[model samples]
Target chain A: MNALALGLRRARFETAVYFRQGDTVFFTFLFPVVMLTIFSVAFSSAGNFGTKPDGSGGITAAAFYLPGMIAAGILLSGVQNLAVDIAVERGDGTLKRLAGTPLPVLSYFVGKFLQVLATSALQIVLLLLVARIAFQVALPADASKWLTFVWVYLLGITTSAVLGIALSRVPRTGKSATAVIVPMVLVLQFISGVYLSFSQLPSWLQSFASVFPLKWLAQGMRSVFLPSTFETLEPGGSWDAAGTAAVLGVWLVVGVVAARLTFRWIRKDS
Target chain B: MSETEHVSVRDLRKTYGAFDAVDGISFDIGRGETFALLGPNGAGKSTTIEILEGYRDRTSGDVTVLGQDPGRAGRDWRGRIGMVLQSSGESGNVGVRELIAHFATFYPNPRDVDETIAAVGLTEKAGTRIRALSGGQRRRVDVALGVIGRPELLFLDEPTTGFDPEARHEFWSLIRLLKREGTTILLTTHYLDEAAQLGDRAGVVVGGRLVALGPVDEIGGQDSRIPVVRWVDAAGQREQRTTEPTALVAELHRSTGGEVRSLEVIRPSLEDVYLDLVAKHDSTATPTGVLA
Candidate 1:
């Protein structure tokens, strides 16, 4: 079989295993949804974000936080989950077994990419449904907004997955994989505006976050889910679509290069 | 190279800094032959196997597996060989059948998934998660995956390390079945009996060198396998190493002119000969730092 065909077969197997595990489902797929719920409920009585500059309407805390949750979901599904998963696989001999096989290294990564894409899609759908039903958050109705969401999501997920593959070698052993990766991801979540408004963060913090992909992902998601009137609240006083695309595009290139350099089917010292 | 040679290695050496993990080893495995590599811990068995499997590169050697240098072999070369590692059930979250089926796609010609599972005696556990299975069952899953590719050559690295007696016997039968189908096997095992039962020929490695290589029963030579005639009489304990133990015992009985007390014949088994070989090698060689 060709690499693509073999990869898709592996992807099917990975997707099944990914969804069946209780820890993976709770941590990767549902963590963002649960956190979003808690944040929306905790701040529900605080009222909406003032009024729209264009006199359009009011946006509740839940509505404002939906895009952040979606962005965070993408990060968790791609980066945090994969970094830990690949490290565990490497330490447990999964990569060694595959290395002994005829499967191409590119095919193995293809399997991972497709698995992340499938799980992330499902996770985002679940998050969206929960936000819509429980918090009554409005869904984006414009086709253009959905198109923006798709592109940003594709770029953000590609960057996260590749970076995750590269970062898998950071942990020396499987037991410490979550310990090493979780803290890094959590720090990125806080600094990238997943848990706080980007404009409300200090200018220095915003500048620091701007160097990473999560910040651009969250900003792009905001542009998709939030109204145009909310654009004035951004640090640049507008939704910089081109800026988000450029930053994400650069990170994607960086991630691909890093993954190519660092990814190994077997440990070198072994 | 012989037309029947499945694997050929000459002067194979793997060096880590100044230490030679595998120092000047040479061997050939014929097609459809089961060759067992026996060694104590850190005796370079794993290093040699890894070099042959292409998982590790040798610092110096001429090596070939299935007519190609394993260090430079491509995916097509990989497809012709299979390996069952020391550990088992890596994809624990996946079902047995599913994982086996997934691996089957990597080979140009793969065995039927269910048939392979059955061959390993895992038919009943096909739907079970590998992690949920017992250690022996998980090992069977490992064997299932190894044979699913229908490999021309299979590497079994301590394949029965944790098996119970019954499971080991069953695994031996499974290996015999694969052998019957003409799979050239390279097996490394600590169990002397396992090697004796399955190997057509055996090689003993010590301190990164091949100390003995021959047919399994003849590894230590005629001197080592000689039967010992032991008896008790007026001369307090007596023993003699002899090829004709029956005649020696009769002569002793006639000389004593009565029933000999505590009379018995001892035939040296492979384990005894192996321990003797290792001890002799250990005493003669100068001490070196741990190589593992």
Candidate 2:
């Protein structure tokens, strides 16, 4: 009847399909949990979690990796998943059929965005649970800290998702989608401090990491979970909440604009 | 826009770079009528259909579907029409009923999902995943979604392109059911028999022009085309093309003392006339800009 109702129906269908696909569920939701568990068990063997350096507590491996894995999970789902799906749909002629239908194109995007949000939300929660129970990782204290995590996570994932939607036009066929999307995601993951420590890298590397939102998003999450004393390990020796929001905010705006310009319902060769 | 006319096009033209895809064509489809636009590949059939479906912009033309210009039509107008594109619609291992029900919400008034599935002969496959189905079965899914909206008008672009004879017959019946329910249909196909079977009226589009448009049986000057009479003569066998086969047969009957062996008369089939028209147009090809 209404666009919202129809869009919601489509979204539920999309999410159901997402869950049914084994690989997608494994990569988007389960992989991070598995990684967090492995890292937590490996690093906490010394049994010094929340009781090192500072008399209060020290950062554990799970605490360090939970944020990075969360960030990576978000990136994988929002960027790789969304973009690859779009490209594959294009190759399969799904988009062309959609263009012919009475359904508004905006409704289709709304469905996909909803799917992204649901999967990403599920991922963050699972990572949080595993980190807390298995590794004794710290949770955000005070309302402001929790508030910071919420906005940063939401904005950062959404920005990546929007960029994914825009970049779907780059690949001509479903087979080509991975070729187009994987390299960029791999570059972002390596340079954004998702796999390695930002402070341990050279100054040029840190500067390079700061240019992207994944770095800030992971840093923002670390700020929430880690004690204030651990801020010295960050790029500017402290959490830059304002900078994180501004950079991600710019990416969201630019992504929306690019999606408007780049989105295509029919491929040229077709 | 006449009340009886569901679609009206005046000099519909579409251009791609320097070439005219849909050069200059004009045709009308009455309300509740099944009109088949038959053409070969690259005959601009798809381009014309796309413009009518509101999926593409035309270079220049006057066209209307359901009394609305498709180029400027909105969701309200779209709600009144259904489309079965050349490509598959459903995706990702979804069951038949689930996919149909999802599409139904996009329309204001929709047919019951079960009824729609049954109408397309997919009742047994309701719970079957789309990807697991055969090509023809998947095509039924396409037809299922197209008619699920209970659209006033339906556009089917090569709907039975890859169908086997049996599946095509089944699809034809489905279309007939829709026609009985008073849904206007505009389908494009390369199969002459398919056009003759399903189309009440047929339009032959060649080089993007409506060369011949009339009832399927009478298309391509059917009445005027001469019939050939063949019979066993004193000289073994003879055949003659004539406007008056009856007279020739009568003479032969009398001369042979009513022993007209192997005598038969046959008029040109639709395929013959269509081939003739296409060949004629192909040889005398002119720039599309010049209206024929």
lDDT of 1 by residue, B170-258 (tens): 89998998899999999999998999999999999998999999999999888888887777877698888888998998898898898
DockQ of model 1 vs. true complex: 0.66
Q: Compose the digit string of candidate 1's lDDT tens values, residues A1-270.
A: 999998898888888889888887898889989988999999899978646566557888888888998999899999988999999998888888889899998788889999999999999998888889999999989999999999999988988898888889899998799899999999999999889888899999999999988888998999998888788888788778898999988988888888778887754453
**lDDT minimum window of 10 residues, candidate 1 chain B:** B283-292
* Candidate 2: tens digits of C-alpha lDDT, residues A78-171: 9888988888887887787776667888789889999999988988888888888876777876999888878888888899899889888889
Fraction of true contacts retained by every candidate, in order, equals 0.63, 0.51
Best by DockQ: 1
Off by over 4 Å in 1: A52-56, A266-270, B89-91, B284-292
All models, RMSD in angstroms = 3.2, 4.0
